[model samples]
Target: MAEPLLDIHGLPGHLIRRLNQIAVAQFMEKMGEIAVDLTPVQYSALCAVKSHPGIDQASIAGLIAYDRATLGKVIDRLEAKGLVSRKVSPQDRRARVVKLTKSGQELLQQVHPVVRAAQGDILTGLDNVEQAQFIALMQKTIQIGNESSRAPQRELGETG
Candidate 1:
Protein backbone atom coordinates (compact mmCIF):
# COMPACT_ATOMS: atom_id res chain seq x y z
CA MET A 1 0.00 0.00 0.00
CA ALA A 2 1.18 3.55 -0.79
CA GLU A 3 1.99 5.75 2.16
CA PRO A 4 -0.37 8.66 2.73
CA LEU A 5 0.99 12.09 1.81
CA LEU A 6 -0.38 15.54 1.11
CA ASP A 7 -3.21 15.48 -1.42
CA ILE A 8 -1.43 17.71 -3.90
CA HIS A 9 -3.58 16.48 -6.76
CA GLY A 10 -6.64 17.92 -5.08
CA LEU A 11 -5.13 21.40 -4.85
CA PRO A 12 -4.46 23.03 -8.18
CA GLY A 13 -2.84 26.15 -6.74
CA HIS A 14 -0.59 24.12 -4.49
CA LEU A 15 0.30 21.83 -7.35
CA ILE A 16 1.18 24.72 -9.63
CA ARG A 17 3.28 26.41 -6.97
CA ARG A 18 5.13 23.23 -6.13
CA LEU A 19 5.67 22.38 -9.78
CA ASN A 20 7.05 25.82 -10.52
CA GLN A 21 9.42 25.66 -7.59
CA ILE A 22 10.59 22.19 -8.50
CA ALA A 23 11.12 23.06 -12.14
CA VAL A 24 13.02 26.21 -11.33
CA ALA A 25 15.14 24.52 -8.71
CA GLN A 26 16.03 21.68 -11.07
CA PHE A 27 16.85 24.11 -13.86
CA MET A 28 19.03 26.18 -11.57
CA GLU A 29 20.85 23.09 -10.40
CA LYS A 30 21.57 22.11 -13.99
CA MET A 31 22.71 25.61 -14.78
CA GLY A 32 25.10 25.43 -11.84
CA GLU A 33 26.80 22.53 -13.56
CA ILE A 34 27.62 24.91 -16.38
CA ALA A 35 28.81 27.70 -14.07
CA VAL A 36 25.96 29.98 -15.13
CA ASP A 37 24.75 32.10 -12.23
CA LEU A 38 21.92 33.91 -13.97
CA THR A 39 18.44 33.49 -12.57
CA PRO A 40 15.51 32.21 -14.63
CA VAL A 41 14.15 35.73 -15.03
CA GLN A 42 17.48 36.89 -16.40
CA TYR A 43 17.61 33.97 -18.78
CA SER A 44 14.12 34.78 -19.97
CA ALA A 45 15.07 38.41 -20.59
CA LEU A 46 18.05 37.29 -22.62
CA CYS A 47 15.84 34.96 -24.60
CA ALA A 48 13.44 37.80 -25.35
CA VAL A 49 16.27 39.89 -26.72
CA LYS A 50 17.62 36.93 -28.68
CA SER A 51 14.31 36.23 -30.38
CA HIS A 52 13.37 39.87 -30.94
CA PRO A 53 16.49 41.74 -31.79
CA GLY A 54 16.33 45.43 -30.87
CA ILE A 55 13.22 45.03 -28.78
CA ASP A 56 12.52 47.92 -26.46
CA GLN A 57 12.68 47.45 -22.68
CA ALA A 58 8.97 48.09 -22.23
CA SER A 59 8.10 45.59 -24.96
CA ILE A 60 10.35 42.96 -23.43
CA ALA A 61 8.80 43.49 -20.01
CA GLY A 62 5.31 43.20 -21.50
CA LEU A 63 6.22 40.08 -23.44
CA ILE A 64 7.49 38.41 -20.27
CA ALA A 65 4.59 39.62 -18.14
CA TYR A 66 7.05 41.35 -15.83
CA ASP A 67 6.39 44.67 -14.12
CA ARG A 68 8.48 47.59 -15.34
CA ALA A 69 10.32 48.07 -12.01
CA THR A 70 11.22 44.38 -11.64
CA LEU A 71 12.19 44.10 -15.30
CA GLY A 72 14.41 47.14 -14.97
CA LYS A 73 16.34 45.41 -12.18
CA VAL A 74 16.69 42.27 -14.28
CA ILE A 75 18.03 44.32 -17.20
CA ASP A 76 20.42 46.11 -14.87
CA ARG A 77 21.73 42.81 -13.51
CA LEU A 78 22.19 41.41 -17.00
CA GLU A 79 23.97 44.57 -18.09
CA ALA A 80 26.24 44.41 -15.07
CA LYS A 81 27.08 40.82 -15.95
CA GLY A 82 27.93 41.87 -19.53
CA LEU A 83 25.24 39.66 -21.03
CA VAL A 84 23.17 42.36 -22.70
CA SER A 85 23.36 45.91 -24.02
CA ARG A 86 20.79 48.69 -24.05
CA LYS A 87 21.02 51.38 -26.65
CA VAL A 88 18.84 54.34 -27.50
CA SER A 89 16.45 53.20 -30.18
CA PRO A 90 17.20 54.93 -33.48
CA GLN A 91 13.49 54.99 -34.34
CA ASP A 92 12.30 56.14 -30.93
CA ARG A 93 14.37 58.55 -28.93
CA ARG A 94 12.58 57.89 -25.66
CA ALA A 95 12.93 54.13 -25.90
CA ARG A 96 15.94 51.99 -25.06
CA VAL A 97 16.32 48.90 -27.28
CA VAL A 98 17.93 45.74 -25.85
CA LYS A 99 20.08 43.07 -27.47
CA LEU A 100 22.35 40.22 -26.46
CA THR A 101 26.04 40.79 -26.88
CA LYS A 102 28.19 38.23 -28.75
CA SER A 103 29.21 36.74 -25.42
CA GLY A 104 25.60 36.54 -24.36
CA GLN A 105 24.68 34.73 -27.57
CA GLU A 106 27.48 32.26 -27.07
CA LEU A 107 26.51 31.70 -23.45
CA LEU A 108 22.92 31.10 -24.49
CA GLN A 109 23.99 28.54 -27.07
CA GLN A 110 26.08 26.71 -24.51
CA VAL A 111 23.44 26.65 -21.78
CA HIS A 112 20.37 26.04 -23.95
CA PRO A 113 20.93 22.30 -24.18
CA VAL A 114 21.36 22.06 -20.42
CA VAL A 115 18.15 23.98 -19.96
CA ARG A 116 16.35 21.62 -22.38
CA ALA A 117 17.68 18.64 -20.50
CA ALA A 118 16.43 20.07 -17.23
CA GLN A 119 13.00 20.62 -18.77
CA GLY A 120 13.02 17.12 -20.18
CA ASP A 121 13.76 15.76 -16.75
CA ILE A 122 10.72 17.57 -15.38
CA LEU A 123 8.59 15.83 -18.05
CA THR A 124 10.16 12.42 -17.59
CA GLY A 125 7.08 11.01 -15.90
CA LEU A 126 4.94 11.81 -18.93
CA ASP A 127 4.85 9.69 -22.08
CA ASN A 128 5.25 11.19 -25.55
CA VAL A 129 1.51 11.75 -26.05
CA GLU A 130 1.09 13.22 -22.59
CA GLN A 131 4.09 15.49 -23.12
CA ALA A 132 2.67 16.77 -26.40
CA GLN A 133 -0.72 17.30 -24.80
CA PHE A 134 0.82 19.12 -21.87
CA ILE A 135 2.70 21.48 -24.18
CA ALA A 136 -0.46 22.12 -26.22
CA LEU A 137 -2.42 22.90 -23.06
CA MET A 138 0.25 25.30 -21.84
CA GLN A 139 0.21 27.09 -25.20
CA LYS A 140 -3.54 27.37 -25.07
CA THR A 141 -3.41 28.82 -21.57
CA ILE A 142 -0.85 31.41 -22.66
CA GLN A 143 -2.96 32.33 -25.70
CA ILE A 144 -6.06 32.85 -23.55
CA GLY A 145 -4.11 34.86 -21.00
CA ASN A 146 -2.58 37.03 -23.72
CA GLU A 147 -5.98 37.70 -25.24
CA SER A 148 -7.36 38.72 -21.87
CA SER A 149 -4.38 40.97 -21.23
CA ARG A 150 -4.81 42.68 -24.57
CA ALA A 151 -8.59 43.11 -24.29
CA PRO A 152 -9.67 46.75 -24.43
CA GLN A 153 -10.95 48.44 -21.33
CA ARG A 154 -14.62 49.42 -21.23
CA GLU A 155 -15.66 53.05 -20.84
CA LEU A 156 -17.31 54.05 -17.56
CA GLY A 157 -20.70 54.65 -19.22
CA GLU A 158 -20.64 51.45 -21.28
CA THR A 159 -22.97 48.60 -20.30
CA GLY A 160 -21.85 44.97 -20.38
Candidate 2:
Protein backbone atom coordinates (compact mmCIF):
# COMPACT_ATOMS: atom_id res chain seq x y z
CA MET A 1 0.00 0.00 0.00
CA ALA A 2 1.04 3.63 -0.38
CA GLU A 3 2.45 5.50 2.60
CA PRO A 4 -0.06 7.10 4.97
CA LEU A 5 -0.51 10.81 4.57
CA LEU A 6 1.11 12.83 7.41
CA ASP A 7 0.51 10.29 10.16
CA ILE A 8 -3.25 10.71 10.15
CA HIS A 9 -3.62 10.43 13.92
CA GLY A 10 -0.58 12.39 15.07
CA LEU A 11 -1.09 16.15 15.29
CA PRO A 12 -3.59 17.95 17.50
CA GLY A 13 -4.42 20.58 14.87
CA HIS A 14 -4.94 18.01 12.19
CA LEU A 15 -7.16 15.95 14.42
CA ILE A 16 -9.19 19.02 15.36
CA ARG A 17 -9.73 19.95 11.73
CA ARG A 18 -10.72 16.39 10.88
CA LEU A 19 -13.13 16.42 13.78
CA ASN A 20 -14.63 19.69 12.54
CA GLN A 21 -15.21 18.22 9.11
CA ILE A 22 -16.83 15.17 10.64
CA ALA A 23 -19.00 17.30 12.88
CA VAL A 24 -20.22 19.51 10.06
CA ALA A 25 -20.97 16.52 7.89
CA GLN A 26 -22.85 14.90 10.72
CA PHE A 27 -24.75 18.16 11.20
CA MET A 28 -25.81 18.16 7.59
CA GLU A 29 -26.99 14.58 7.84
CA LYS A 30 -28.93 15.24 11.01
CA MET A 31 -30.52 18.38 9.61
CA GLY A 32 -31.64 16.37 6.64
CA GLU A 33 -33.38 13.95 8.93
CA ILE A 34 -35.32 16.87 10.35
CA ALA A 35 -36.01 18.31 6.89
CA VAL A 36 -34.44 21.66 7.80
CA ASP A 37 -32.01 21.62 4.86
CA LEU A 38 -29.67 24.14 6.46
CA THR A 39 -25.93 24.19 6.09
CA PRO A 40 -23.86 24.54 9.25
CA VAL A 41 -22.84 28.09 8.40
CA GLN A 42 -26.43 29.10 7.82
CA TYR A 43 -27.38 27.75 11.22
CA SER A 44 -24.52 29.67 12.82
CA ALA A 45 -25.53 32.86 11.08
CA LEU A 46 -29.06 32.39 12.35
CA CYS A 47 -27.85 31.84 15.89
CA ALA A 48 -25.67 34.95 15.72
CA VAL A 49 -28.54 37.08 14.51
CA LYS A 50 -30.75 35.60 17.21
CA SER A 51 -28.23 36.58 19.84
CA HIS A 52 -27.60 40.03 18.38
CA PRO A 53 -30.76 41.32 16.82
CA GLY A 54 -30.30 44.33 14.59
CA ILE A 55 -26.61 43.60 14.25
CA ASP A 56 -24.89 44.67 11.03
CA GLN A 57 -23.35 42.41 8.37
CA ALA A 58 -19.72 43.24 9.24
CA SER A 59 -20.35 42.46 12.90
CA ILE A 60 -22.15 39.25 12.03
CA ALA A 61 -19.24 38.27 9.78
CA GLY A 62 -16.84 38.83 12.68
CA LEU A 63 -19.10 37.00 15.13
CA ILE A 64 -19.29 33.97 12.86
CA ALA A 65 -15.63 34.15 11.74
CA TYR A 66 -16.82 34.43 8.12
CA ASP A 67 -15.46 36.80 5.51
CA ARG A 68 -17.81 39.66 4.69
CA ALA A 69 -18.26 38.65 1.07
CA THR A 70 -19.17 35.08 1.94
CA LEU A 71 -21.40 36.19 4.78
CA GLY A 72 -23.14 38.57 2.41
CA LYS A 73 -23.89 35.63 0.18
CA VAL A 74 -25.14 33.70 3.19
CA ILE A 75 -27.32 36.68 4.07
CA ASP A 76 -28.64 36.68 0.55
CA ARG A 77 -29.60 33.03 0.86
CA LEU A 78 -31.19 33.61 4.24
CA GLU A 79 -33.15 36.54 2.85
CA ALA A 80 -34.36 34.39 0.01
CA LYS A 81 -35.50 31.78 2.52
CA GLY A 82 -37.27 34.46 4.58
CA LEU A 83 -35.28 33.40 7.59
CA VAL A 84 -33.53 36.74 8.00
CA SER A 85 -34.27 40.39 7.28
CA ARG A 86 -31.87 43.13 6.34
CA LYS A 87 -32.45 46.83 6.45
CA VAL A 88 -30.11 49.73 5.83
CA SER A 89 -28.58 50.80 9.10
CA PRO A 90 -30.18 54.07 10.20
CA GLN A 91 -26.96 55.28 11.74
CA ASP A 92 -24.81 54.07 8.85
CA ARG A 93 -26.51 54.16 5.50
CA ARG A 94 -23.70 52.17 3.97
CA ALA A 95 -24.23 49.28 6.41
CA ARG A 96 -27.01 46.73 6.58
CA VAL A 97 -28.43 45.63 9.90
CA VAL A 98 -29.78 42.10 10.13
CA LYS A 99 -32.40 40.38 12.24
CA LEU A 100 -34.22 37.07 12.27
CA THR A 101 -37.79 37.22 11.09
CA LYS A 102 -40.69 35.40 12.74
CA SER A 103 -40.18 32.40 10.49
CA GLY A 104 -36.54 32.43 11.48
CA GLN A 105 -37.48 32.49 15.16
CA GLU A 106 -39.81 29.56 14.64
CA LEU A 107 -37.18 27.71 12.71
CA LEU A 108 -34.73 28.26 15.57
CA GLN A 109 -37.19 26.85 18.03
CA GLN A 110 -37.48 23.74 15.89
CA VAL A 111 -33.74 23.45 15.31
CA HIS A 112 -32.55 23.50 18.92
CA PRO A 113 -33.71 20.02 19.78
CA VAL A 114 -32.39 18.70 16.50
CA VAL A 115 -29.04 20.33 17.15
CA ARG A 116 -28.87 18.89 20.64
CA ALA A 117 -29.61 15.46 19.28
CA ALA A 118 -26.91 15.92 16.70
CA GLN A 119 -24.43 16.96 19.39
CA GLY A 120 -25.14 13.80 21.30
CA ASP A 121 -24.57 11.78 18.17
CA ILE A 122 -21.30 13.58 17.48
CA LEU A 123 -19.94 12.80 20.97
CA THR A 124 -21.36 9.32 21.28
CA GLY A 125 -17.92 8.04 22.13
CA LEU A 126 -17.89 10.09 25.35
CA ASP A 127 -19.93 9.48 28.46
CA ASN A 128 -22.03 12.32 29.85
CA VAL A 129 -19.29 13.44 32.28
CA GLU A 130 -16.68 13.19 29.57
CA GLN A 131 -18.94 15.12 27.23
CA ALA A 132 -19.20 17.96 29.71
CA GLN A 133 -15.46 18.00 30.21
CA PHE A 134 -14.88 17.82 26.50
CA ILE A 135 -17.10 20.82 25.93
CA ALA A 136 -15.33 22.82 28.65
CA LEU A 137 -11.95 21.89 27.24
CA MET A 138 -13.06 22.79 23.75
CA GLN A 139 -14.25 26.16 25.00
CA LYS A 140 -10.92 26.78 26.71
CA THR A 141 -8.94 25.75 23.66
CA ILE A 142 -11.08 27.85 21.34
CA GLN A 143 -10.58 30.87 23.62
CA ILE A 144 -6.86 30.39 23.46
CA GLY A 145 -7.07 30.15 19.68
CA ASN A 146 -9.04 33.39 19.51
CA GLU A 147 -6.47 35.17 21.67
CA SER A 148 -3.56 33.98 19.53
CA SER A 149 -5.37 34.63 16.26
CA ARG A 150 -4.22 38.24 16.01
CA ALA A 151 -0.54 37.30 16.07
CA PRO A 152 1.42 35.97 13.09
CA GLN A 153 0.34 32.47 12.18
CA ARG A 154 1.48 29.66 9.93
CA GLU A 155 -0.23 26.78 8.19
CA LEU A 156 0.29 23.32 9.66
CA GLY A 157 3.15 22.29 7.36
CA GLU A 158 4.38 25.68 6.20
CA THR A 159 8.14 26.01 5.89
CA GLY A 160 8.11 29.37 7.63
- Which number leads on lDDT? 2
TM of each candidate vs. truth? 0.82, 0.83
What C-alpha root-mean-square deviation, in Å, does candidate 2 show against the real structure?
6.5
lDDT of candidates 1 onward, in order? 0.80, 0.83
Q: Mind sharing the TM-score for model 1?
A: 0.82
How close to the true structure is residue 104 of candidate 1, measured as C-alpha lDDT? 92
Off by over 4 Å in 1: 1-9, 147-160
How do the residues 35-149 of candidate 2 rate in per-residue lDDT, one tens digit apiece?
Answer: 8978888998899899889988877777766667888999999999999999999999999999999999999999978887778777878999999999999888876686355
lDDT of candidate 1 over 1-160, digit per residue (tens): 9878777767967876777888889888988888888788888889889988888887777767666677889999988889899999999899899999998999899888788767767777998889899989977876666636532222222322
Q: Relative to the unseen true structure, what is the C-alpha lDDT of residue 24 in candidate 1, on a scale of 0 to 100? A: 87
Worst 10 residues of 1 by lDDT: 151-160
How much does each candidate deviate from the true structure in C-alpha RMSD? Answer: 5.7, 6.5
